[model samples]
Target chain A: MHGECCFESEVLAAVVECRWPERVESELRVHASGCAICADVALLAVALREDREVLKSIAAPPESGRVWWMAQLRARREAEKAASRPITAAQVFGAAATAWFAGACFGASSDWFRSEFVRLASGAESAGIGVFLTSGVGLLLLLAAVSIIILVPAAVWLAVGKD
Target chain B: MFRDATLRDAIAAALAPADSESGSLVESQDVRADFAMDEDSFRSFYDRTARGLWAYLARVTGDRQAADDLLQDAFYRFLRAGTEYESEAHRRNSLYRIATNLARDARRRSVVRPDAVVSGEDIERVAGADSAGSLDLNADVERAMSRLRPNERAMLWLAYAEGEPHVEIADRLGLKVGSLKPLLFRARRKLAGLLRGKDSDHAR
Candidate 1:
């Protein structure tokens, strides 16, 4: 029984590691001839290992692969048309300009800056330096707006028409 | 676990076929089934697995944003795939494999792009406050996982965390089971070494 128990201990290690083979089973049978305890331990260990695996199997959650794959497929589908459409220099330029315009608009509309602009405009009539600076800024703004209204559309048309 | 029968029934009901005059569209039904996953299942699954997937992807790409995108992408794919498994274990193994592939593909497509949006500090902060297990252990695991090659990490995590059998893992990974034993041993040794390093660093 002692010898059989020792043999079962050895088999238990192999079984835990999932390395059990036919030879190990045959060897176990030979050892079990003398040791019933060893035989019982061997059987118990196998059952325990099987139970452990079953519990592990049960505890595991579902795979998210199909979900991940679906996302990949969806991304591919969404990207397909856009990917086929070449990114043009005009698109880059337009994006940059749009960003700049938006930033400028945000800056202009900000309360802090709007208050400062009002203060400067109000003080311009009283201060000679303010008057010249304000009018100079006003004229520049008008010129810029007019230039953008004309040249901007023309450039956009040129860029678009090129393609 | 049985006490959660109500939630399971909810999921089952959500997965149940809808009656229609037109021939039932399995494809559409499958897509809608995710909604039936109940808040509990979705939250539990996301909480338990999403972070692991994210951490794994971040380690692979060394980018937090990329990991986040991939994580979301992975979940979205899972929702759309209509994959059915006989058991949750099979489902999880499949999910990890898919996530690994997605991360690999993303890495291949853009080497220069940032893969993860969140910084390591942010991840640590979130993990630290988490009540699940010790943050240190999770951190160590993440650092250890970071050191492995993509496939090695995937194999180890699936084996250790998911406790999948070699055959199931091999099937999921499209590898022969015979080829996995030695590879798994080596990967585990490497991960153990990495984890030890993390522990040592933390100790200091």
Candidate 2:
């Protein structure tokens, strides 16, 4: 390996640079004519140069309009998908607050309704009919509050997702 | 932080009432206003550069489908950024920079994926399939390229394959202009060695 022909390796560096004058290629060709290794290096350079062209031809990308359109479409789709996932701190906080409010209202109303039912059934009311009417009205108000608390935010969330 | 900004823009774009999907393709008032590049300008830019960029990507990644996906992603990100370029070359360089990063990231990801491993014979067969043996040069080129580092492949491709000047390659790859020449020279020398060593083995 101490006697290795520098042209055998140097020709490759020259070819890779691709700035070699015709004189350089001619000299390399002459040197290659007498040496097998140099010839291989020269061949490699030509093959590489030719390969670039091959890549250019084969890698015909999609049409400009198509590429552009697809990019826009993809961005929009990804954006929409990202928007749908509720992971942001603000979004998480909003959801939590909505859940808590709904849970509190439902719990309080259910507790009151349970107590009212027990009292009404045990005949502990001075005005039994009036008490029943009041309890019925209270239950309706609770149901309305629960519906608003649950439905409004759910509607808002769905609308946000759509947007 | 960059992801956060991208995420924010993406969310904003998503939440806007879409004018129409098809209509949005040619001209999006939202994108145009943000980027300040009208439909014609973008179309013109795309017409001039997309194919070449795609070619660069394909050679770098050695995968046509990956090139396709990256090409789209590159353009989408470029549009999303909305940065004003002083000139077409600057814009082109910026696009290539985005593409280079995307291809690099894709390569990194593929290395981690279990199924990304392909046999040497399979790669050769696929590379050889492009054209008869005349284009078979790419087969060897791709084979040799697989042996090099990703950045080496990129610098070599941009310098030799794409004919980009040293300064431009530097900017695109985030290297200083002074360092680009030596780096590119080293990459070329290394690739030449890889090509010789690998192909010689195949010949035997």
Candidate 3:
């Protein structure tokens, strides 16, 4: 196997440092030139090390401060979103509850609603949609309840966007 | 350990009822309160590792733009991880590991293997002042490297470019040392063959 050898590391070091076959001792240089494994190591190591040096020399990563502040900004946004989640949930819950309660109150106060609901419950061929349309206050309250159901989530969506 | 002390505190405050997974892209806020490295420490670490990490990413992915994006992502994820490290080397390993996985995922997500934009102009342009045949050598390297598997490129680069040993390479690449030797050997041989083939083509 061209994989294991005691001198592979030394040859690799000399090559990486640009010392192989010249700056290093003649004995090692001769060995590296002669041994297949050492020769392969020298070839690849020097090429890669040179490439690495060129890359580092030419490449300029963004300044550390910029990266830091960007991270901080992102973390803050994440935190704000996290904080708003429960609040949003509570808002939706509250809106739904209020809509339900207002509908219940409107139904309890309206004689027309009681008569129509009981008629439907008794499986009677009761008055159709036009009857509820005529029950003015109850109709208004039901419309308001439906509006709240539709608008609250729309408001939350508008406020939060799509995350 | 954070000198600022505000980041995690803010996260903790916000995430009080935090396990709310509803439509959340950031999987869990369970560890939101625990970033161990402070801003100063993070800044210092970024300064130390960014260049090297960028080079590693650029070479492995063959996309400098992807490398740039992934580099920032790696640092952010590292900070967000809130992991406490035992040593500087450990921290580096963790960062590199995160970077490696991100690059891997990015590659898998990419519909096609990204073209090797690591051109001769980048490498030989620097060594242009130095030895003879530097142009041909660098071009050959870039060409040969593009042909290897990403893991192979990573192993060889870590070994030669970063001068990391087999054990550390294995750890960073998520391979056991026992399995790494053969794989590294095979990769190195493939690389040598490609380089040799290039030489022969020129000779012909």
Candidate 4:
């Protein structure tokens, strides 16, 4: 029942056109004076129309060309991101495979690796601090592993940044 | 809308095959390849809707600066949206919906709205220089509208400010058409009461 009036649209149309009580037909003005919904609609519509005008005076939306250019730039950037996804994935896979191959080669190279693997577990547990650093070969391998972990991503990022 | 003749010319220049020696023509062609609407069509659409859309954003967010950001964003998203429109009205509705959502998201991200600078050229000066009552009413309505919920403001605005149909208003706000009437009624009633209260105060 609320907000429902048979004359609501007629009243609304008149208000939108700035006719309302002043210029509308005598019968419609009489009805608006009596109908609660129509009266409220008129009051609200006039106020909002004014507010909209005020806002229009204040708002200066950017030029369409600037908007268009920004959209194009964003689209191109997104395209670059989309195109690089497979390359990024491949980079990660390549790094992992290299690490795995290096591990397998180290495992296969010497009986010393088997003994050292056992020593590594016990040495890491008991002789914690200097265990790897004390062994020259282990120290070299540790530094190499650390360097790759730190460097590969940085290199890729630099490469991407350059592009 | 077609007022930005300079920018339009620049866009035209960029889109045209001039200065091919720099290969910029090829780059611009690639840029156009992914655009949702061509240059002329987009210019026409922007000319038609930009002011209304800007006003809507300004009112809904209660900030002109935010409206600037949201207007550009809405158009960009609209272009990127790439949804086929059945008509100009449909496309306009789509842009409104996008703009509404963006305004909602912006309000959520920043709980405190930036103070909108109501410019020196007041609406009263432009709209009602001769009628003092109308001037007071405009300012009063502005203050009272700030008291409504954003959704309520949006509803009232789309309904009365834009003079949108119930169906278009419903679509723009993503509401069921049946429910929009009562909701609009409550919002209108509240706004009317607030406006009357001001009128009485002015009378005193």
Strongest candidate by TM-score: 4
What interface RMSD do all candidates show, one decimal each? Answer: 13.5, 9.2, 6.5, 4.5
Better of 1 and 2 by DockQ: 2
Quote fnat for model 4: 0.48
Which lDDT tens digits does candidate 2 get at residues A70-106? 5555655665456546545466577667778877776
Winner of 3 and 4 under TM-score: 4
Please, what are the lDDT tens digits per residue for candidate 4 over residues B1-204? 544567657656754554353344235456567677986788789978998898888778777788888888899888888777899999999999999999999999994374543654554445545455555555686678788999998999999888999999999999999999888888888888887877733211
Q: What is the alpha-carbon lDDT for the whole of candidate 4?
A: 0.75
Residues B1-204, candidate 3: write the lDDT tens digits.
233446446645664454354344454333335455776788888888888898888788977788888989999889888889999888988899999999999988992255655554565446456634555665687789988999999999998888888888888999999888888888888888898887732211
- What is the descending TM-score order? 4, 3, 2, 1
Share of true Cα-Cα contacts across chains kept by each model: 0.01, 0.25, 0.40, 0.48
> What fraction of native interface contacts is shared by candidate 2?
0.25
lDDT string for model 4 (A1-163, tens) is 4658898888778878977667888888788778888888777777777667766655577777667766776665566556667767777677667667766766676587666667777888998848867988777766766866777566556545544
Q: Which regions of candidate 3 deviate over 4 angstroms? A: A88-135, A138-142, A145-149, A152-161, B1-35, B111-113, B119-128, B131-135, B200-204
Tens-digit lDDT string for candidate 1 (A1-163): 0121346446546555665545466766576545544443333334323322322222223344334333334543344334434544646588559657955865775775466467566767567444645566555554565776677667666556544
- Give the better candidate number (2 or 4) by DockQ: 4
Q: Scored by CA lDDT, what does every candidate get?
A: 0.53, 0.65, 0.74, 0.75
Compute the lDDT of residue B125 as modeled in candidate 1. Answer: 39
Please give fnat for model 3: 0.40
Estimated TM-score per prediction? 0.41, 0.62, 0.74, 0.77
Question: Compared to the true structure, candidate 3 yields what TM-score?
Answer: 0.74
In candidate 1, position B27 carries an lDDT of 40
